[model samples]
Target: MSALTAPHLNRWLIRLHRPALFVWTVVLLGLGSALMCLWGPLADASAEAWQQHYACAPTGPCLYDQAAILRYKHIYDYATMAVLAVPFLVAAWTGAALIGRELEQRTAQLAWTQGLTPTRWLLSKLTLPAALVTAGTGLLVLLHHGMWWASEGRIGSAKSWYDPPTFYAGGPITVALALAGLFAGAFAGVLLRRSLAALGAAVVAVGALWAGVHQALPHLWTPVTGVSSLESDLPVGNGVDVSTGLLTADGERLPDPFCGSTINPQCERLYDRLGAVSWYHDYHPLSHYWPLQLTASAIVLAVAALLALAAFRVTAVRTRGLS
Candidate 1:
């Protein structure tokens, strides 16, 4: 059995998952091709649509090709979603096929009886899938970064850099996120040891992780503050406005007395009475993107590492007790 030794276990694992490998290969190639097209034709098409929108809507109802706009939008949306969903996919498979099913079927115990240590088996499962998730998500993240860079000033409908989905897919964090999903799934499998339960638990875990990040993201970076006189138009800047309010001459912040264009006469007089002078905006400039992305990635990868450790330790203890 030297030909089928532990060192060759990864190969066996890959062979066992040939269909998953095929699907991942197809997905990567397809996504890469789609992104490449988006950098060129899709971007051009969307720009033209925006141009037509502006031209047609200048003084009359727009008659431009709404279908073209929608199609480009659909393409971009699907691409973003495909990249963002990689983590959950990893989690589901890891929970269902990697650890959960092996435990549920007692197959992992059989492997242990044949000389594979529980720790080694768990490591093998985590390592193979972690490598695949890292490579796959890394490629997609690079593609998205390139696409975003190439289409920055060109595509009118491309989301802002700090937009949650854009931030999620356009940086190194996506790779870390996929790894986290793998680890989370493994941990759930180890904890639950039931395929369906583990699957559900892992998905919920990843979703909670995502939601937590989304909530904390806006606060991760310090925002640049700008003040505009109440009579002036709001300053046009490309940044995420976290908070906006009217600032009194004494520097106290209060809700806009103008109440966002309703133009309450009483509120207007109250604004003059309270000495509210300017509208202030607290926002993150485009330059803050990397800081937020990296910080978030660091947090996620750290959590993933903890989960991986927990999985190994828990399994080691459980299997030792079983013996």
Candidate 2:
């Protein structure tokens, strides 16, 4: 028993220290650093713009610019996409290589004969890669937080940071999803025994899973809502008027008028004649975010585990036949 366990532990250690793992670490750190550096400049620009248009007073006539908020939203959307793509690509590449190459090169036979238990062997193979992925993703989350902090106080009239899907960004859910993809890819390699084919299968499988889960599930566990206060000239008398809204403790929308021409023809005819209008809107979730993410990831991981177990059984059977 001791001998068997020793060999298994050694294999795990060797796999963990592989060059590929180091490369993954470096790549993630580099990407995170680059993104973090960009936050300062973006925040500065946003702050400068805010100072120009909006008055920061304790109590007075204040307005939110919808157009500027939209512009920021657009920029953040693209930035987030680029940030997320890195983890997904890394997970896919690493996962495909995890078990695929071993089977392709027929190395599993020798490794099994070296007195390693199948469970330990499989765990060893997965441990380092999984850790690497988790660490990288954690760094990404940190970078996201930094950017969020930098932009927080600056954007007064903008939408809620959580409004855009990009703002949901990469969190625990995303890390779990990427890890599930890796597991699925590795399982594909076990079943297919060909690197390229396993990679293709993994891609298709993950894509389908992501699409299905995202569509079927709504924001329940992770409530993603965008809240923004916009102050624009309400169209009154061939011109625009200004308005504002308030939110109740229960998140109910309440309008509060500040100033506007009541007698203006456009204000009476088009602007609802309520002067400046203030109101709040709430976006309710159709479903939970965390539970669905977890469930979907679990399903993929279960499938991967089953596939690995099947591969182990097949290999053991073949060994017995030769004996």
Candidate 3:
């Protein structure tokens, strides 16, 4: 195929792979939609209601409380895992079959004889899937941003776009990580010439890289640190229960119904008296989001590219025997 036809061929390849991709996409969309719907109701419900509904007793209010659930750390965690992991996993499997299946089935020689360059072949295989993954991740990022903004005061303690959760949670870093895995898996397939074994190796390597970087690098670089507090009124028998809005580092507290209430003597007395004040110190990826994400992604990409190059160098057409 001519240079102008390369994109068409890539699209064709994607079309051919649509069955698997569609299944994976449906699974991802289902997971994301479920979380999006569930988190909202959970956030709006009272702490006691949430505990009773979920059938778990938290030490204090559950993190699903409106103020806490909207936090960037938690939001990004769920969104990113849902949006990125499925595509990456699917791509890794597809990539592992890129060359290994051809070699295993003795089709490499026929393609080589047809004058298809290895570089063009590999590029064609990588570009379409990578683009699909990037687009999906971008959508997920936008969704998280919209949700965070809508939550208003609830998201006061959430990480910002520059936060690590945002970086690793489902954005450019996720796309890059998936691309890296694709390339690495493709390279392993070329080297191993066995689809299953290559796939196993690729999965292990990708998992290790993702987990290791996420766990070890956050502390080594800039970390997110902040304070959050919540206060609520306790009710006596048959009395009204009052709750205060959460307070954050900015010292802005939400409007509480019990504030300045004089009619209820007990409520007024409790207001004057010291109430239950809960404070917590949380570490999120607020500062080092981009730098660490970029650095890690680049490292993985570089390794993958080098492996692909090595595979290209070693690949040879077998005239009378299997590759």
Best by lDDT: 1
What TM-score does each of the candidates earn? 0.89, 0.60, 0.57
| lDDT for residue 84 in candidate 3, whole number 0-100 | 51
Model 3 local distance difference test score: 0.54
lDDT of 3 by residue, 183-288 (tens): 6677667777787777777777677767766665545444333333333232211111122242334554433434433346764564344442333232333345
Taking the tens digit of each residue's C-alpha lDDT, what string does model 1 give over 159-247? Answer: 87877788788898778878888998999999899988999888888989888877887788788888775655463355766788788
In the predicted model 3, the residue pairs found to clash are 72-158, 164-285
The true-versus-predicted C-alpha distance at residue 104 of model 1, in Å, is 0.4
Name the 10 consecutive residues with the lowest summed lDDT in model 3: 234-243
Superposed model 2: Cα runs more than 4 Å off: 1-19, 38-41, 53-79, 156-168, 219-282, 285-323
Candidate 1 residue-wise lDDT at 197: 91
Better of 1 and 2 by lDDT: 1
lDDT of each: 0.81, 0.56, 0.54
Ranking by lDDT: 1, 2, 3
